[model samples]
Target: MQKQDTGKKLTVSLIVLALTVLAAIITRLTGLETTSAKLIGSFAAVFLLTGVVWRFPFRFYCMAFGFEVLAAVLGSALNLYHYLGFYDKFVHYTSGIVLAEGGLILIHALAGRRHTPAEPLLCRLFSMFFAIAGAGIWEIYEFTADNLLGINMQGDNTNTMGDIISGTLGALTWFGIHTLMHKRQQEKQ
Candidate 1:
C-alpha cells in the first residue's frame, strides 16, 4: 500500500514538473523574454534538486517536489506574483513549510528510522533551521540576480526582509501543526 501511494505521488510530481517545463517553453516561444528566463531558471533549479531528492528514500520528498514545481509555475509562468499582491508572500510561506518537511525527512532518514514522533524536538528544530537557511540562501540568490542580471527579484531590502519573516512564520506554523498532529496520534496509539 505504501509503495503504491509513493508511486502515485511520484507520478503526480513528475506531471507537474512536465507542465512547468512546458510553460517555460511556451513563454520562450512567445518572446516573453523576461518571464521565459524566470520560468526556465526556476524550472531548471527545481528539476536538478528533484533529481537529487529522488535518490532519497522518503515519500515526503515527493510532496515538497510537487509544491516547489507548482510554486515556480504559478510565480513565473502564470504571473501570479504580479497579478496577486499577496501571491509572493503565499509562496514564500509555503516554501518554508515544504523545506521544513524535507528537513524532517532527512533527519529521520539519516537517523536510520530510529527517531520517533515521541522525540520530535530535534527534528522540529532542524526543520525550523532548514527553513530559515533556505530563506536566507534564496535572498542571496535574489540579490545576486538583481545586481548582476538587472532582475528585480529583490526589489529592495524591505521586500527581502518581509519575505524572510513570512517564511519563518510559515515554518513555525507548520511545526506547530505537525506537533499537534503527532501528539494526537501518539495519544490514540
Candidate 2:
C-alpha cells in the first residue's frame, strides 16, 4: 500500500477504535451488557482482520468495515432488527457483497504471490461460490446459536431461505458489476 493509503487506513482504524470504546462505555452505562459485549467483540474482529490483511483493497476494506459497524453496532445497538423487518435481510444481502469482494481479493492476492494473474472467469466463479458458502455458513451459525443457546436467532425456514436468496442476489449484483467492468476494460484494450 502507498504511504498515504496506509495513513488513511490508520486514521480509520483509530476512529473505529474510538467508536468501539465509546460504544462499550455507553452500552455498559445503559445496562446493555449483551450489546456492549457484542459491539466490542465485533469491532475487535473487524479491526484485527483489517489490520492483519494488509493486501486487501482500501475501498473494499472500508466498505466491509462500514457494513460491519452498521449491521453489528448500529443495527444491534439501536434494535433495528426488531423494529424493521427488512433490516435483517438487508444486512445479510450486504454481507454477501462483502464476502464476494473478500473472496476476489483473496484469490487475487494468492495469484499475485504465485506471480500469475488469475483468470477472470476463475475469479468470478470463486467469488460467487465463496459468497454463497459464506451465506450458508452464516445460516448454520444462526441455527446453531438458536438450538444450542435457545436464542431466537433463526426465525424459521422462511427467514433462512429469504436470507440465502438475498445473499445470492447480492452476489449476483457484484458479479454483474464486475463483468461489466471487465468488458469495458477488454473493449479499451
TM-score, each model?
0.78, 0.83
Where is the poorest 10-residue window by lDDT in model 1?
28-37
lDDT string for model 1 (1-189, tens) is 357666865675577778787777766676543455677667785667666666554556666666666577767776667778898888889888888887887777767666544348888888888888899899999999899998688977889999998889888988899889879988999
Query: Over 4 Å off in model 1, which ranges?
Result: 1-6, 21-34, 42-46, 113-118
- lDDT for residue 28 in candidate 2, whole number 0-100: 71
Per-residue lDDT value at 111 in model 1: 77
Q: Model 2, which residues run further than 4 Å from truth? A: 18-34, 52-55
Residue 126 Cα positional deviation in candidate 1, in Å, after optimal superposition: 2.0
Against the reference, the lDDT scores of all candidates come to 0.76, 0.80
